[model samples]
Target: MTLAVPPTVPDPSVRSAIERLRQEFPELGPAPIVLVVRTCREELRGSPDGALPELVERLARQRLRVSLD
Candidate 1:
């Protein structure tokens, strides 16, 4: 008999970070928000789990804000 494995779900903080960035930079719209979040997450992929959410949020915010300037 074989058992099935479930797909890995991303942490909620990732979504939260994305949404917060979207709200903070509405002018950039959904596509840019998603891009920034994904980029930030990738940059911190090796980071400690406990710190990822806040790190992702901060990095994404900075990147998006810089884009606006």
Candidate 2:
């Protein structure tokens, strides 16, 4: 599951992730799928500015099947 971006900066990559999941789980049908994105304050260790986009880009760099189509 991919994290939903903040209102100010939407992430287009999420749609690819959703499409990936759908292909893997065709039985899902039209039911709603929800996966909340969360990172504990401690885990962040006071992340730098623009952390969300940074993290998202870093994740994309890993070549996660989030999109290789």
Candidate 3:
């Protein structure tokens, strides 16, 4: 029998970051913005939890902006 794993709940800050990114980069669409944010979150895995949200948002924003060029 296979055990089912529950979906991971995103951190509130991360969710907020995603929403902000969606608003800022509406032209890129939700999928790309989410991918960028998730990538940033993974890259920042070792960072202190207290700062992860802000750092993730900043990094994601920078990446999204660069993608525009």
Candidate 4:
């Protein structure tokens, strides 16, 4: 079963990286303050033509909070 995780702000590192990505991909608009758990991961899954997973990996490397059920 999947557990529900509370919404939380990204770490400073994630904020920084996301800001940079935001500038590069205006399609994403502003940097997100809160990560919506699994959906957030899905959003960053990246399109075949785009390479956003590398960017999301930054969060995974940093302190992006998450929980598994």
Evaluated with lDDT, which candidate comes out highest?
3
lDDT of 3 at 32: 80
Q: Compared with the true structure, what per-residue lDDT tens digits does model 1 show for residues 1-65?
A: 12223216766667899888788788888987777787777778799989999998998898778
lDDT agreement of model 2 with the native: 0.37
Q: Whole-model Cα lDDT per candidate?
A: 0.76, 0.37, 0.79, 0.42
Encode model 4's per-residue lDDT on 1-69: one tens digit a residue. Answer: 232244374444344555555554454344332342233444554544244445544544343333221
lDDT of 2 by residue, 1-69 (tens): 334333344444434444544555455432322132121212333566456444533443333333333
lDDT by residue (tens digit), candidate 3, 1-69: 122232287566568899999988889999887777777777777899999999989988998898899
**Comparing candidate 3 with candidate 4, which one achieves the higher TM-score?**
3
How much does candidate 4 score in TM-score? Answer: 0.32
lDDT of 1 at 38: 73
* Residue pair clashes in candidate 3: none
Every candidate's CA RMSD: 8.3, 8.2, 6.3, 11.5
Q: Name the regions of candidate 2 deviating beyond 4 angstroms.
A: 1-10, 34-69
Where model 3 places Cα greater than 4 Å from the true spot, the runs are 1-7
Worst 10 residues of 4 by lDDT: 60-69
C-alpha lDDT (0 to 100) for residue 26 of candidate 2? 53
Clashes of each: 0, 0, 0, 0
